[model samples]
Target: MREVDLDVFASELAEGAFAIDVREPDEYRAGHVPGVRTAPLSELGAHLPALPADRPVYVICASGNRSAWAAERLEAVGVRAVSVAGGTSGWARTGRPIVDGTDARSA
Candidate 1:
């Protein structure tokens, strides 16, 4: 799994990069990148087919661990994916915007 700095991740997002958040529903509900898809690690296999294969998907979580694991799994199956180096915390700390709404993931 490749690691990505928040700047690169933000730039990629601005340029319309695809992203997947591999955190559990509860964690995702707390907060996540604005354009990221919620594909929790537990359900990645079923959700993988829904993701675009041609684009680089940014995998993220509260920390970097779960996303990295998801990245590895995606790469193993030939999906182009990378992990956000410090995950959501990094993005939040870097002043990147976040979607402050209800926890949609849990529902």
Candidate 2:
């Protein structure tokens, strides 16, 4: 429903914000924020309990589009979620820590 910058998202994560990567498993396997959980938009409903409602859930993907849509879906289902502006690509470019199958550090 709202937007957040990569740096702000990073700081929020540091402060314990709940982050979710609403991308395909393969895409997420390629790369993602170090602490974000993989909660694909396609199956967000059944996994709603896995998300913490007390805090805002930050959503991200390759770009921000899908995450934005996912944010809307999350809103429809009463979950407070926001799409990070520019998503993972922006996070990567912002020098935030990320993790992949073989790498688990800043990029």
lDDT (Cα, tens digit) per residue for candidate 1, span 42-69: 8888887787877787888887888888
Q: Give the TM-score of candidate 1.
A: 0.89
Each candidate structure's TM-score, on Cα atoms with residue i matched to residue i, is: 0.89, 0.88
Query: Which portions of model 2 show Cα errors greater than 4 Å?
Result: 102-107
- Lowest-lDDT window of 10 residues in candidate 1? 98-107
Q: How far is candidate 1 from the true structure (C-alpha RMSD, Å)?
A: 2.4
- Candidate 2, lDDT over the whole model: 0.81
Count backbone overlaps in model 1.
0
lDDT score for candidate 1 against the true structure: 0.81
Report every candidate's CA lDDT: 0.81, 0.81
